[model samples]
Target: MKQTYGYQQKARQFFAVLLPIFITQLSLMATGFFNTIMAGHISQQDLAGVAVGVNLFLPFFGSVLGIISGLTPTISQLYGGGRQDKIGFIVKQGFYWAMALAFLFIAVGWLAVPRVLPLLNLEPKVHYITAHYLLAVSFGIVPIFLAGVLRNFIDAHGHTRLTMCITMTSVPVNIALNYVFMYGLFGVPAFGGIGAGIGSAIAFSLNLLLNVWVVTHIEPFKSYRIFHHFPRPQFSEWKKQLGVGIPIGSTMFCEQSIFGAVGLFMTVYGTVVVAAHQAAMNFTTIVYMVPLAVSMTLTILVGYEVGAKRFADAEQYIRLSRVLTMVFVGVLALLLTQFKTEIAALYTSSREVQPILTGFLVYAVFMQVSDSINAPLQGALRGYKDVHVTFLLAVLSFWVIGLPGGWMLANWTAVGPYGYWIGLVAGVLVGAVCLQIRMGQVQRKFSGQEG
Candidate 1:
C-alpha cells in the first residue's frame, strides 16, 4: 500500500512537471507554425526554400539541443539526490560546450551556406532569401544553446514551470516580430523568409536573456555553485554525459534525417509537390512538439526518482508519462485528421499541391502517435543512462527499414510519395519497439543493481 501510494505521488509529480513543459514546447512549435503561415503567404517557393534550408542545417541544430540537453538528467539526478555542490561543474561545462558549438557552427554555416545554396536547384529569387535566412538563424545558435541549458537546469530542480514562463512569455513577441519583419510593417525592408529567421533569433535572444535573469535570482537556483563558478569539464562527468547524450542526439539526428531524406526524395518528383509535402509535414511536426514536451519533462522526473533510488516510482512515472503523451497525441490526431484539408490549403493556393498533400494527411496522425511514444521512451532510457544502444537501434530502424525500405517502395515501385512515407512509418514502429525493449532491459538491470 505504501509503495502504491508513493507511486501515485511520483506520477502526479511527473505530470506537474510534464504539463507546463508540454505547454512550453507547444508554444515553441507554434512559433514555427506562425513562420510557416507567414512564409506561405509570401510564396510557395519561399516555404519550400525554408524546408530545404532547415534540413541542410537540422543535424547541426539538433546537436546544440542534444549537447546541452545532456545536462538535464545528470544535473537533476545529482540535485534530487542531494549532491548540491557538484551541480556547478555541470552547468559551467554545459555553458562552455554551448559557446564552443555556437562558434563552430557559425563558422561552418557562414563559409558553406552560400556554397550550399547553388547545390540545391532553387529559384534565382529564393537563392538570396535563403542565404540571408541561413545567416540570421546562425546568430541565434548560441542563444538557443543558452536557452536550452537554462530550461533543462530549471526543470532539474523541480521548478519546471519557470522555463515555461520564459517560452510562453516570448510567443506573442515572436508572432508580432514575424509580422513586423516579414511584411515590413515596422518601416523595415521586406525580407520575406529571412525576416522570419531574424524574428526567431530575436525571440530566442530575449528568452535566453530572461532565463539568465531568473535562474541567477531565483531560489534553489541562486544557491547553486554554477552562479559562483562553472564546473570545469571533467572526463568522468563528460563521459557520463556523452553516455547519455550521444545516443539521444544521434537518435534525433537519425529520426530527423530520415524524415528530412523523405523531403529530399520528394524533390525527385518536383519542387511544388515537395513544397506541399513540407507543409503537411511541418504541421504534423508542430503537433508532435506537445508530446515532446511531455517526454522531456518525464525524463527530468524519471531522472530524479531514479537518482533517489525509487526504481518502482521511476518505472511508474515512465508508464504514466507515456499514457499522458499518447492521450495528448490522440487528441491532436483526431483534430488534424478532420481539418487536414483546411490546414494544407492554407499553405498553397494551387490545385495540384492540395491533392498531393491530401494523400499524406492521414500519415500525420500516425506519425504523431509513433513519435509521441518513441519520444518518451527515449527520455525514459536516458533517465536510466541507457543511450549507447539507442545509436544502433536508430541506425538499424532508420537505414535498414526506413531509408532502404522507403527507396524500394517509392522509387522501384509506383507507390509515389505515399510509398516513401510508408517506410517512415515502418521506421517509427521499429524505433519505438526497439527503444521500448531497450528501456525495459535497462530498467530491469537497474532494478537488480538497486536491489
Candidate 2:
C-alpha cells in the first residue's frame, strides 16, 4: 500500500508538471500552425517560401532555446538544493549570452539569406518572399531569446502555469497580428507571406513583455529580484553554462537542421511537393509537443531529485516518464494514421497536395514513435548534466548517418522525396537506441553511488 501510494503521488506530480508544459507547447506550436495555414491560403509558392525560410531559421532559433534551456535544469537543481538566491545571477548571465547569440544570428541572416536562397533556384516570387520574410523575422530575434531566458527561469521554479498563461495569451495576439499583416487589415497593407514574419516579430516582442511582467510582478518570482541589477558578462559564469549549454544547443541544431535539410531537398521536387512536406511536418511537429513536454518535465523533476540527492526518486521519475510518453505517442500515432487525410486537408484544399501530405504523415508516425523513447531520455540525461554524449550521438545519427543516407536514397533510388523521410525515421531510431543505452548507464552509475 505504501509503495502504491507513493507511485500514485509521483504520477500526479508528473502530470501536474506535464499538463501546463503540454498546453504551453501546444500553444507555441499553434502559432506555427496558423502561420503555415495562412501562408498556404495565399498560394503554394508562398507556402514553399515560408517553409524554406522557417527551416533555415529554426536551427539558429532552436540553438538559442536549447542553450537557454540549460538554465532550467540548473535553476531547478539550485531550487532543490535550497540555493534560490543564486538563480537571479545565473539568469542575468543567460540574458547576456542570449543577446550575443541574437545579434550573431541577425548578422548571419543578413549576410547569408541572399547568398543561400539563390542557390536553390527557387521561383522569383518564392525567393523574394523567403528573403523578405527572414529579414522581417530577424527583428524579433533578440526579444525571443531574452524571453526564453526568463521562461526557463520561471519553469525551473515550478511556475510552468505562469509561462503557459503567458504563451496562451500570445497565441491569439499572434494570430491577430498574423492576419493583420498577411492579408492586410484596417490600416495595414498586405505584406503577403512577409507578414507572417512581421506578425511573429511583434508576437515575440509581446511574449518578452509578458515574461518580464510575470517575473517582476509575481510573488515568489518577484522575490528573486533577477532585474535588481544588471551585471557585466562573467566569463566564468558563461563558461559554466557553456559547458552544459553548447552541447545542448548543438544537439538541437543537429535535430532541427536535419528537417531543414530535408525541406530544402523537397524543393527540388517543385512547389507542391515542398508545401505538402511542410504540412505533414507541421502536423507531426504539433503532435511532437507531447513527448517534448514529457521530456522537459523529466528534466525538471529529475534535476530536482538529483539536486536533493534523491537518486532513487530521479530513477523512478525517469521510468514513469518513459512509460507515459510511449503510451501517449502510441495513441497519437494511431490518430495521426487514422485521420491523416483529414489532417492533410487542414493545410490545403488542393487534391495534388493532399495525397502527398498524407503519404508523408505515414513516415512521420514512425518518427514520433522513435521520439517517444529518445526525447524524454535525452531530457533525463540533461537532468544528470550528461549532455556531451547525447550531442555526439545526435551528430552521428542525424548528420553523419541520417543526412548522407537520405541523400543517396533520394537521388539514386526510386524512393524520391519519401527516401528522406525514411532516413529521418532511421536516424531517430538510431538515436533512440543509443540514448536508451546511455540513460541506463547514467541511471546505474548514479544509483550505485547512492547505494
Candidate 3:
C-alpha cells in the first residue's frame, strides 16, 4: 500500500511540473507552427522559403538553447543542496553566456546566410524571401536567448507555472501579430514569409520582458535579488557551465542539423517537396513538445535528487519518467498514425503538398516512438552530468551513420525523400539505444558511489 501510494505521489508531482512545461513548450512551438501555416496560405514558394529559413536558424538556436538549459540542472542542484542564495550569481553568469551566444548567432546569420543560401540552388524567388526572413528574425536572437535563461532558472526552482503563463500569453500575442503582419491587416504592408519572422521577433521580445519582470518582481525569486548586483563574469564558473553546456549544445546541433540537412536536400526536389516536408515536420514538432516537456521535467527532478544525494530516489524518478513518457507518446503515436491523412490536410490546401505530407507522416509515427525514448533518456543523462559520451554517440548515430546514409539513399536510390526519413529513423533508433545504455552505466556508477 505504501509503495503504491509513493508511486501515485511521484506521478502526481511529475505531472504537476510536466503539465505546465508541456503547455509552455507547445506554446513556444506554436510560433513556428503559426508561421508555417500562415506562410502556406500565401503561396507554396513562400512556404518553402519560410521552411528553409526556419531550418537555417534552428540548428544555431537549438544549440544555444541547449547550452542555456545547462542552467536547469545547475539551479536545481543548488536548490536541492540548500544553496539557493548562490543561484543569483549562477543565473547572472548564464545571462552572460546568453549574451555571447546571441551575438555569435547574429554574426553567423549575417555572414553565413548570404554565402549558404545560394549554394542550396533554391529558386530565386524562394531564395530572396528566405534571406529576408532570416534577416528579420536575427534581431530577436538576444531576447530569445535571455528568455531561455530566465525560464530555465525559474523552472529549476519548481516554478514552471510562471513560465507557462508567460509563454501561453505569447501564443495569442504571436498569432495576432502573425495575422496582422503577414496579411497586412489594419493597413500595414503585407510581408508574407518575412512577416512571420517579424511576428516572432516581436513575440520573443515580449516574452523576455515578461520573464524579466516576473523574476525580479515575484515574491519567491525577488528575494534572491538576481538583478540587483551584476557580477563580472567569473571565468571558472563560465568554464564549468561551458563544460556541461557545450556537449549538450553540440548534441542538439547534431540532431537539429541533420533535419536541417534533410530540408536542404528536399529543396532540390522542388518547392512542393519542401512545403510538404514542412507540413510533416511541423506536425511532428507539435507532437514532440509533449515528450520534450516530460524530458525537461525529468532533468530537474533527477538533478534535485542527485544533488540531495538520494541516488536511489533519482533512479526511481528516471523509471517513473520513462513510464510516463511511454504511455503519453504511445497514445499520441497511435492517434497520429491512424489519422495522419486528415491531420496532414490541415496544414495546407495544396493537393500536391497533402499526399506528400501524409506520406512523410507515416514515417514520422515510428520516428515519434524513437524520439520519445531518446529525449527522456538524454534528459536523464543530463541530470547525472553524464554528457560527453552521449555527445559522441549522437555524432556517431546522427552524423557519421545517419546523415551519410541519408545522403546516399536520397541521392542514389529510388526511395528519394522516404529514404531520407528512413535514415532519420535509423539515427534516432541508434541514439535511443545508445543513450539508454549510457544511462544505465551512469545509474550503476552513482549506485556504486552511494554504496
Candidate 4:
C-alpha cells in the first residue's frame, strides 16, 4: 500500500517530463490541422489529392521515424541503468541510422512514387496534383531525419519541452509559407497544390534548423556538449541500439503497412468516399494526438523507471497514464459528438463532403477508446524489447481482423464505407486486448528477470 504513493511520486515526475513532450506531440497534430484547413481552402480535388499523397507515403515515413524513435527509450534506459558513457554512443548510432535511411529513401521513394500513385487509381485532377505535391514534399525527408536525431536525443536526456518550443515556433511559419506559396502572396510564384508541398518543405527545414540551434544553445545540450560527446559511435554500443531498435521499427512497419493497404482499398471505393474519409480522418487525427502524446510519454516514463530498477513504479506509471489518457479522449469524443456538423464544416465548403464526413466523425468518437489503449502497451512492449510478439499481434489484428473485415462489410455486404470503419472498430478492439495482455506479460518478464 505504501508503495503506491512512491509510484504516484514517480508518475508525477514522469508527468512533469511529459508536459513538453505532449506539447510537441500537439504541435505535430496542429500541423495536420493547418494542412487540412489550407487544403480545404484550395478545392476538394486539391484537398483529396494531398490526402492521398499523405496516405501513400505515410507508412514509409512512419517506418523511418519509428526506426529513429527507438533510440529515445534505449538511451533513457542507458542513463537510468547508470551506463552514462553509452548515452552519447547510442545517440550517434541513432543519427547514423537515420542518415542512412534518409539516403536510401531518396532514391527509392522517387522511383516508387510514380508507380504507387497511379496504382491507387485516383481521379485525374487529384492524381496530377498529388504527383507535384509529392515531388516538393520528398525534398524534406533528409532534414526530417536529421531533426529526429536531435529531437529524440533531447527527449531521452529528459528535456522534451525544448523540442516542443522549436516545433511551436515552426507552426505559424509553416502556415504563412503555405499562404505565400499557395497563392503567390508577397511576390512568390503561385504553384497552387505544388506550393503546398513546397510550403511543407520550407517548414520542415526550419524545424531542422531550429532543432540544431537549440541543441547548440540550450542549457541541457549545450552544458553537455552533446555533439562533441558523440564525435563517434562505439561499435559495440551502436550494435546494441540496432539490436533493440530494429525489431521495434519493424513493429511500426507492420501497422503502417496495413494503413497503406487500406489506402489502396479506398481507391476502388471512388473519389467522393476517399475525400470524405480523408476529412474525417484529419479531424480524428486532432483527437488522436491526445492519446498519442500520452502514450508516448508513458513509454519514456516506463522506460526510465525500468532502467532505474524501480520495476513496480513503471507499472503504476502506465496505469496512471491509461487513466489520464482515457479522460482526455473521452471528453474529446463527447465534444466532437456534440459538434459533429460544425467539425465537418471545417473540412470542406461543399455540402456533399460535409454530410459524408459526419459519418466518419461518429466513427472517430467510438474509435478513441481503442486508440487510447493501443499506444502505451505498444510503448511498454517496446520498452521491454518484446518486439516479435508486438509485430505478429499488430499484423494479425489489423490485417486479419481489420482489413478483411472492412472488405467483407464494405464490398461483400451492403454497408459500403461503414463496413470498412466497422472493421476499424473491431481491429482496434482486438488491438487493445492484445496490447493489454502483452503489456502485462512484458512487465512481468522485465520485473522478475533483471530488476
TM-score of every model? 0.88, 0.90, 0.89, 0.87
What TM value does model 2 have?
0.90
Candidate 2 per-residue lDDT over residues 396-449, each given as its tens digit: 889977888888889999989998888888888998999989988987788755
Tens-digit per-residue lDDT, 1-451, candidate 3: 0111366787877788899998887777777777888899999988989988987788788898998888888888778767878889999998997899899889978999999998989999999889998898888889989999998888987788999999889888988897888889999999988888888889889999999999889977888887887999898999998888889999989887887678778888899998889778867777888778877888888887777777787787788987877887778778876888789878888898889888999888888888888989888888877789979988988888788888889889998978888888888899899888888788888885541
RMSD of each: 3.2, 3.1, 3.3, 3.5
* Residue 143 C-alpha lDDT in model 4: 90
- In model 3, which regions exceed 4 Å deviation? 1-5, 42-48, 121-126, 185-188, 266-278, 336-359, 407-416, 448-451
Index of the highest-TM-score prediction: 2
- lDDT tens digits by residue: candidate 4, 1-451: 0123575676667677777877777777666566766787888887888777877667778777887887878867766677767676566667777777888988898898888888878899999989988888888888988898888777776777777788889977887787788778877888776777898888889989998888789764675565674566456765677676666777777766765677568868778878888777666666676677776676676667667787777777877877887788778878887998998888788887788888888888877778888877777766655666777777777878998999999988888887777898789889889888877777677666545
Query: Which is superior by lDDT, 1 or 3?
Result: 3
The per-prediction tally of clashing pairs is: 1, 0, 0, 0
C-alpha lDDT (0 to 100) for residue 117 of candidate 3: 95
> 169 in model 4: Cα distance from truth in Å?
1.1
Local accuracy by lDDT, each model: 0.77, 0.87, 0.84, 0.76
Q: Quick one: best lDDT, which candidate?
A: 2
